[model samples]
Target: MAKVLMKGNEAIGEAAVLAGCRYYFGYPITPQSELPAYLAKRLPEVDGVFVQAESEVAAINMVYGAGSAGARVMTSSSSPGISLKQEGISYIAGAEVPCLIVNVMRGGPGLGNIAPAQSDYWQSTRGGGHGDYRTIVLAPNSVQEMADMTITGFDLSDRFRNPVLLLSDGVLGQMMEPVNLPEPNDYDINSKKWALGYRGNDKNERNLCSSIFLDNDELEEHNWHLYQKYQVITDLFSKGEYKDFAVEEHLCDDAEIILVGYGIISRILKTVVEKCRKRGIKAGLIRPKVLWPFPTAVFERLAKTASQFLVVEMSCGQMVEDVKLSVDGKKPVFFFGRTGGTVPSDFEILNEVDKLVRPD
Candidate 1:
């Protein structure tokens, strides 16, 4: 495979088309609008379907319809647009439809700015839609991962019969980088026996696609089954890459505190860690690539030896909740961040680290 320079959004769209996703339904939203525009041109060449639905709601329902028919389907939107699609997302989950949802998240609350932000971390990981379901959310920091994970999301969704979310921020979606596209998998969409259109004149064959279970016991049974599936997903899918400098002696081995972050902030935190190392402050980073099914055990192991943890993000300490939960009050977990498009600088993180290491 030859490596080509591509923007993150374009890379995702190209990856899906190459991965044999034949149906794409989406409406325009900032920071990720390039994705639909790219697909509009590319899908027709491949004889694929690209429908700009009347609204995000319609787009997701279109996804539901395509997915039920056993076609590889996808949709993309920003935070607010994703919110509109949540209802349909819940329906997709209920129907066990396999599809990919790309959330190139922007600033939040309501009709937030178009700048890049990680405000949708919780929403993506914790089932942005209603009901007791979880979307397998993958957070990618680079343009390459954005493309690669889009393919991975489709595979996982089909394997488990669920929705998989490819969560990226506006920064990653707009950034340009080199990516080596993967070879197309030899898959036959017609081979799937459970697709809605495949139902025929067989006598034992009354299959109904629905999320509405009227009987309470039946609903409970369905919920338990989904829970078991989630457990399997957790065991099989949790993954991440860690950069531990001098981790043998605790990140400090001879110092006091460490900084933890992921996504773009983790890139800046790496610089802070290097600066701290130069000053003999001993710091390292634990960047969780898979935000959902978070690497909680890794943090727990680190908490046993690390003196303190300084978590950095671009939100109002959203991921901090998970950090605290993982640490289980074993040590001090401090949060430092600026929300609503105000990204903290390496210097700012360094100052926070300094303050934690040598308090007032």
Candidate 2:
């Protein structure tokens, strides 16, 4: 009920616990290690399980095991660590198991730096692994959102019977701010009749959770089913079913120049928007709270009025492509990015916006 100063990573750990996540399996990775460290100290107090697995690959598989048994399970990692868990993530998705994956992104292509970056946008939104699967991606822009999205990630995972990713970055993962932690959620594991170990006297049907459909037709049918589910999620968000979980439109009503960003970059863009308005530039922002099932409809609507769109990120232009596709040539889409963990200042972004709006 009260607010307290907390670091983003630790706040996320506490939020996961409150979301009824009784099982946590993860390997330590920078920018996100504090989360598992906090859970190690806190989970035991609540009778939850905290396991530091031998490898990132192992950690994700453990999540698969716990989630298959109808438990609220989660795993976290940084960029390279997440890459290692891709196959396991794919397996979990194929099996349609409910779980949460936290990716506190860092600079990368190799084992980049421990510093923050948004270079993983394509990997996160396009299903990083080798499959026709989709993971629901939720991006948080602040320390408070890091905690809030963690709770929402778990609920959405269970609701859709799929993995939900909280795509944060090193900046938000390491930042400290006051947050109002929510009350613990009440989860009924038995309500998940599709999961294994659901208790219903002696008449419960044996539940099997597996992604291996040896029969070609069976696999094809399964893939189609997953596709339909993804369509439903995209359609719902487009219809404004989930507010605050999809996109945030700031001052975009009559904006001629629309700024786009997500995670921590959006925080910076908010300032740029205000600065542009102060300068009478008619600038606004469309921040995608959820990366996948991207708020394409929003862009389509704004493309009619907005003369151009500028996408700012902590890495070389990634999300800009999606904005381009969404705008679909109705209006020009531009991009400015800083790579290798560099964060762009509001003034730097404003300069980019000036070139587009002024062009003198």
Candidate 3:
């Protein structure tokens, strides 16, 4: 299997095709338009369907319809676009429909900039819209992971009967790298017993997909069921079932200071870790690949050993809150961030680490 040089967004599009995604409904947005563009052209080649819906809200509803019909469906957008789709996302989660959503994050409180940012961390992990539901969020730090996670996301979506989010950013969306794309996955749409279009004649019941459980008690029961499923996912990641893609613990064994980050910032933190080692500072890194079930166990395990934790992000500070929660004040949690499209350099971060280690 030979690797191909491709941009992150394009790689995601191709990976979805390989994952047997035959339906895509999304609106174009900066830093991620390439994904839709690639799919618009490539999906047809594979006899797939691609629709550039009029708006993000409409696009997500379209995804819901297709997913309910047992199709491997997907959608892509940036920060603001994802915001508009939140209500529909919540509905999908509540209805227990399976689909893949890609959010190529950009600077934003209100369409801030086309620059890369991780401001959506809270929204992605905290169930952005109404209701008490969760979407499995996967943060990829590289172009290769971008492709790999897209494939993994679809599989997870189906396995859990829930939506899966590939939380990327502008940097990863636009960057180009060589990716060894996975072989095409063979999926049976009719095998979804819960879906409306099952082919097996043995099925005698009608499958209805709807988030509206009018009765309060019925909704409560549904919510509790969703909670149990989420717990199962959290347990799996904590137990290292998906450790390879859940989190990356680099040089944290005996490190006194640990750095925490995800997405592209993790790549920078890795470099800072190397530089810290050269300076004789025991610095480690915790990169969460699965952001929703956030791999908090790693932070909990390291808090007793590591002196302090420094969380780096592209936003002013979002993920740091999660780190603090994970560490539970057992160790100090510090944060360093640059917003408005400004990416922090390795030198800037190493200096922060120096201050933490050699406080004046």
lDDT of each: 0.84, 0.92, 0.93
Tens digits of per-residue lDDT for model 2, 1-360: 799988899999999999888899999989999999999999999899999999999999999999999999999999999999999999999999999999999999899999999999999999999899999999998888988999889888988898999999998999999999999898766678788887763675688899999999999999999999998888877775675559999999999999999999998999999999999999999999999988888999999998899999888889999999999999989999999988999989999999999989
Q: What's the C-alpha lDDT at position 33 in model 2?
A: 95
**lDDT tens digits by residue: candidate 1, 202-309:** 775745668999999999999999899888877664432222210112244444576777677777888888899999887877777777777677777778778988
RMSD of 1: 3.3
What is the lDDT for 296 in model 3? Answer: 83
Poorly placed runs, candidate 1 (over 4 Å): 199-206, 238-256
- RMSD versus native structure for model 2: 1.2
As a TM-score, model 1 comes out at 0.93
Ordered from best to worst lDDT, the candidate numbers read 3, 2, 1
lDDT of 2 at 94: 96
Error of 3 at 158 (Å): 0.3
Best by lDDT: 3
Model 3 spans > 4 angstroms off? 201-203
User: C-alpha displacement of 142 in model 3, angstroms?
Assistant: 0.7
